[model samples]
Target: MSTKIKANTDAFIKARVVKGYSQRELARHSGLSHAYVSLLERAIKSVGPSTAKKLSDLLDKELEELFRIEMQPRP
Candidate 1:
């Protein structure tokens, strides 16, 4: 099983900015790599459940507000 997170880019960036967290800062506080944070913000990469929750919590936003999560089964 694979889960993909499609982030609401505008909301994600806005929330982070509103919270005064830069990409690197957010990543550091979230215990995620800065590269991954950059990729996620650019929609170049997707995150799993735990990572998604971490970001949402750290950003002080609802999970559904920042991301559209989908679960897909690999063939």
Candidate 2:
């Protein structure tokens, strides 16, 4: 996977975990499929702006914040 993709996936997973939500819960809350959430977290799929918006809403964060977080270096 590309580094940016990996970074985004990592950020998504980390944010979800920090929110104390399971993948299934996040899927339901974000109107995304559980499998898709898994794929996103695994860096097997790229998230479009719409999906990112849903996730940002579910996380109660700004969309730009989500994008910024996704682009940050992991660890």
Candidate 3:
């Protein structure tokens, strides 16, 4: 099952700023929806692993620097 990833907002923003990618551009390049990117940035939604990976790759940022990946309690 896919799990939620905790993205460090400040780090994420910094990475994006350094890469000079707007949310829409990041989403498009990452193959994610713009709204999803927005939600992640807003801390309204946790990023999925694949999405995180895509963003990491596209932004060329280290995954750990962007996200706090931890095991979660199963529902």
Candidate 4:
């Protein structure tokens, strides 16, 4: 997978885990399906911009932080 994709996946998983939330719990909080969450974690699907925003809102993080491209520098 590309570095950006890997970074997004890693960030998503790490954020959720750090919050002590399971996939199911994150799905519930984010209003995304558990299967969709699974697909996201596995990098089988790309998360849409709106969905990423929702996840950021749910996780109380900046949307940019969630979907950043690794090693590209952050503003």
What are the models' TM-scores? 0.86, 0.67, 0.82, 0.72
Candidate 3 deviant stretches above 4 angstroms: 1-3, 70-75
Q: CA lDDT, every prediction? A: 0.90, 0.71, 0.83, 0.75
Q: Give the poorly placed runs of model 2, Cα more than 4 Å off.
A: 1-7, 62-75
Ten-residue segment with the worst summed lDDT in candidate 1?
A: 1-10
lDDT of 2 by residue, 1-75 (tens): 223422255667778888989999998888889998888777677677677777887877666655533355557
Question: For model 3, how does the per-residue alpha-carbon lDDT over 1-75 read when each residue is reduced to its tens digit?
Answer: 345687889999889989999999888888778998888887778877787888888879888889986567776
Instruction: Report lDDT (Cα) of residue 29, candidate 1.
Output: 99
Q: Is candidate 3 or candidate 4 better by lDDT?
A: 3
Model 2 collision count: 0
Please tell me which predicted candidate would have the highest lDDT against the true structure: 1
lDDT of 1 at 4: 89
lDDT of each residue in 7-55, candidate 1, tens digit only: 7889999999999999999989999899988888887889888889989
Q: Identify the superior model by lDDT, candidate 1 or candidate 4.
A: 1
* Candidate 3 local distance difference test against the native: 0.83
Q: Any idea what lDDT model 4 has?
A: 0.75
Cα shift from native, residue 52, model 4 (Å): 0.8
